[model samples]
Each structure stands twice: as structure tokens, then as C-alpha cells.
Target: MDWTGWIERWGEPGVLAVAGLLVGLGFGFFAQRSRFCLRGAVIEFWHGRFADKLAVWLLAFSSAVVLVQALVVAGGLDVSTARQLSARGSLSGALVGGLIFGVGMVLTRGCASRLLVLSAQGNLRALLSGLVFAVVAQAALGGVLAPLREAISGWWVVEGGPSRSLLALFGVGPWDGLAFGALWLVVAVFFAHHSGWGFWKWAGGIGTGVMVALAWFATYQVMSHSFEPVQIQGLTFSGPSAEWLMRVLSEPGKPWTFGLGLMPGVFLGSMLGAALGREFKVETFGPGYSLPRYVTGAVLMGFGSMLAGGCAVGAGMTGGAIFAVTAWLTLGGMWLGGGLADRLIDGRHA
Candidate 1:
């Protein structure tokens, strides 16, 4: 089904990037409209409310798993090449790095994805933080911090051993994708009806879940069929943000690909969504000097997401969809970290 051969009669390299942009736009739009923040979702539970945000996230995750499984059953996609399930994934890194990212998001008041949406609404704080995040993430990934990160990660990244996926652990193959997906589907259905949920929230969860699957499909099939195939991947923010910056500064004319295109799409789509929602406003730093706080937090998040291999949307939602143990470990670390930070913030205000 070499799509590139069929489509290349009139095809372009930017096709993958363009697909990423369109999908990313929808992801950003829904994220903003639904106020989807995993930190807020988790902190809410600690505040004694029913963690509606968490439930919504589960819906997205479970739904993603189900869809991915469908692709496996149909022999339409492969998750092995995805970073979340790859050998480079480290249990130790996922725990430590995810904890750092979680706490950082709590302080910054958003994750990388949220930062983009918040910036669209004129939050200068988010804008600054996002910039710091991109720079630091790039550094951690392949710049000054790369050596240290490699050192820390090499110690624990499983080498030639059973992979971290449950299916892999049990010596299973693609059918496990479907089994795992169905498992999450049930979890999503169980939390379908929560009090105080609006129509848009439900829609956002389902829509985001579908979008994640679309990401998998688009990259796996479309890119595979292209003149140049890309490593199959789903939605992720941290590393791509850095890649976007590098592309802008050094390779503005470079052809678009799935990840690079997705970054700007999320940013642009968030702005459109904010404007439509009438939530667009020129905002500045909150009470008393919080600029430094966000910068510091952004630094932590930059390194953290890179170390953990993904952020909330990447690891928490997308990776968790396939029941990746690494995603769960990192997600658990994020919740614990976010809870701790929320309590500290509460203590200060109390």
C-alpha cells in the first residue's frame, strides 16, 4: 500500500507535516475549550472533588487504546517504533522525570500543551515559560545536558531484555494491542458520566482520544506510504517544541514532517479556539513576581519531559492508551508530584 507511490504522482514532502498540523490544531482547540490540564485534574482530586479531569483523561486514554488495538487487529499499524514502547524507555527515568515534570507543571500552572493554549489567550507567563521549556528541552535532548541525560538514562534503559509493555512481558504480539485497548475502553465507559460534566467536556475527551488514534494512523500508514517513511509515532509535545525552534532558527526552509508540523498547528489552533471562545486577552504575570518562578519551573519541565521520554499528553494520555508500564509509572509519578506541589501552594496561601 505504498501510499507515497500512489500519492507521489503529485505528492510533496510537507504532506506529513501538514497532516500533523491539522491534527495538532484539533488537539489544541479541544484542549483549550475543555480546560484539559492533567495537573488540575489531579490537584482537584486532592482538593476532595471527584477528579473529573482524571476521568476525562482516562476516557481519552482508554479510547486511544481501543482504537490502536483495532489498527493492530486489522494489521494497519505498528506501535513498536513509537518512543513510548521502545527500548530507550527507562523505568527509573519515567518515575524521576515524570515527577519533575508534574511538579513543574503545577508551578507553571500548565504543561507544554497548556502553555501553548494559555499563550494563545494572551498569557505572557505561559509564553515565557513555553520558550524556556523549548530551549531547555532541546538542551537536555541533544545539547549541553545531553551527556548527563544519557548517563542517567543509560543506567536503567532496558538493554536486550523484555520490553516494558505488558504484552511484550508476556511474550505476546499485536493481538495484545487490541486486548489492552479494550481494557481501557471499559475503564473509559465506567467513568463516562460524572457530575458537573458539560457536553463539551465529554466531547473533548472522545475527540482527543480519536485524534490520538488518528495520529497513529496518519504516521503509520501515510508516512509509511510516502517517498520517505517516518518512524511511527503518536502525539507528543516536549521534544517537538524544541525541534520546532531549531527548525525555525536553522532550517526554516526544511520540508515539513509530522512532529514539526504538529507543533505550530497546536499553537495556531489554540489561538483560533481562544478567539472564538472570547477568552483571548492580553495577560501578564500574576500577583507579585512570578516570572522567575515560571522560568525555573519551565527548566525543570524541559529536562523532565525529555528524561521521561514524553509529557502528560505524550506519555500520560497516548502512551497510557496501550497500557505501557512506563506511561503508568510516569503518570503515577506526575500525580504524586502534582499533589505535593498543590499542597505546598495551598500552605502558602493558607
Candidate 2:
């Protein structure tokens, strides 16, 4: 649709970048306040800990699902061009990529988003890992590793299959977002029943979910109303991190992008959170040889997230409610990999 001209007309680099920064800042603030990491939340629940964190996670995702669906229905947003919308990435890629990303998150002790927040909080170790992750992700997107990524994705494309949510199989509805959201909310409420998280923590979690949906709505507004259409993407960290890094190297003269705004916002917001909590401290790897683990994990995450098409934040929670094939497949793979990491890590200490 001659998006280039549209970008020129409406996507004033400054405005778009600022919009992205605001969205990112909202996400970072809420996430930090809530301590929201899907990996940690799910794993904590798995360990027989109370499901407060799990409830928080589910509530956020389900809430986002409800709002995102409603926004699309209201015609306030259109996501036809989003990465999550394609629904045709290679299943094989999802499997391998999801698993690898999960394992990497375990090694690094956090996901891509978590690493960025940590980096901002003065974790030099996290900064290094985050850089490696962004650089490697860049390779998969269009650098030396692009050919390999393309080849793998081409090999296992989920061609000719319905890309809609599992609910479609029931034939009762198609993208019945309200019903879908209701079901998730019900589940979340049920879990929340026993959770001990105070009202404020729960609010933070719910706020995070709303922000996720708001990201979609905000980006959609920009894409639909402007004479020029920007890519209709929502919040995600993996590729955006790389995009920002690559731009710094190649397009140093250009201002930050809308998508790129989230990375720095998350970092800065997290730093602010830490400072407020008196938890801000420069952290580094201690003796006992931690560098290899972090490096390997970062590399795996970089490639795996690219291969799987999204991380937990991008695919598991955001794409998850949509019933996208990649969402389910990636989460499934992440579960397997995360479980494996749990066992390996436990055994190492044992």
C-alpha cells in the first residue's frame, strides 16, 4: 500500500518514537511493579508455591485478550500485518525455536524483556547478555543467519491449515473474542480465589495486561488513521531490541523508532522501579563461572525467539489468546524447555 510514502507523511520519526516510548514506559512500569515474568510465575506455581503469581499472569493475559479482542471488534485497531496475524510460520521452527528460547531464558534467569529491565537496573552482566541477544537476533532477522532462518521456516511451513484459534474448531463462533475472553477470565478468577497477592499487586498485574492490549490499540490507531500506514505491530521485545541495536550501528543518524521505544523505556522504567524500591545496585557475576551460562543462554534466546517468531511476552501471552498456531506451539515448546532447564539446574546444585 505504498507504506513508504505513508511513513514519510504521518510517521514523523519523533512522534512515532515518542508514542512507542510511552507505550513501552507503561509496560515497563507495570511489569516491574508486578514482578511479571511468565517464566518465573509459571515455574513458581509449578513448584507448589501458591498460584498468586500464576493467577496474576493468567489475569493479565486474559484481561489483555478481552481488551484486544474488543478493540479489534470496535474497528479501533487492525492487525492484518502483525507478525502474530500471519499464522503460517513453520511449525518445525516454532518447536525448535520455542524450546531453545525457553532453555535460554532459564540459563539467563530471565526472558528478553526481563534482561532489558535488569540491564537498566545496573546489571552489567545483564547488559552484556542483552547485547548478545540483540546482535544475534539481528543476524536471524537479516544478517548472516537470515538464510538459515528462512530455510528452516520454509521447510516446516504450516500451509493450507486454518490459522484461527482452537475455538473455531467448535464451529460455535469465529474469533468470538468476548466468549474467549470470558473463558479466560473465569479461569483467572478461579485461580485468583486462593492467591494471596494484595489488591495492589493484583492491580499491577491486571494493569500490565491492559497495557499489552493498549499497545495494540495505540499502534493500530497510528496505522489506521494516518495517511501513511506504519507496520501494525504491538508490544514485543526480542526483535525490537535487535532492530534498535542494528539501527544504532547502521542508521545512526535516524531517530528511535516506535517499536524501538519500548526497549529503552522498559530499561529506564525498571531502573526507576529499582531505585524507588531501594533495590538498585550494580550486580555482576560472582566466582563459580557464570559467564558461559549467560552467554550461551543469550545466544540461544536470540536465535530461538527469532525462530519461534515470538517470546513468552510476544507469543505466549499476547498471541496466546488469539489462538494463533505459533502462539500455542511456541508456548508448548517453551514449557518443555523450561521444564528441562528446571531439572538440569536442580541436578547441577544437587
Which lDDT value does model 2 have at 27? 77
Candidate 1 TM-score versus the reference: 0.90
- The top-ranked prediction according to TM-score is 1
Q: Which ten residues in a row have the lowest lDDT in candidate 2?
A: 159-168
Per-residue alpha-carbon lDDT of model 1 for 106-134, expressed as tens digits? 88988888898898889889999999999
Q: Which pairs clash (backbone N, Cα, C closer than 3 Å) in model 1?
A: 3-225, 4-225, 65-181
lDDT, each prediction: 0.78, 0.75
Over 4 Å off, model 1: 5-12, 160-162, 171-192, 348-350
Which candidate should be chosen as best, given lDDT against the real structure? Answer: 1
Candidate 2 has an lDDT of 0.75
Model 1 worst lDDT window (10 residues): 5-14
Kindly provide the TM-score of model 2 when superposed on the true structure, using C-alpha atoms: 0.88
Regions of model 2 farther than 4 Å from truth: 1-12, 159-175, 287-289, 348-350
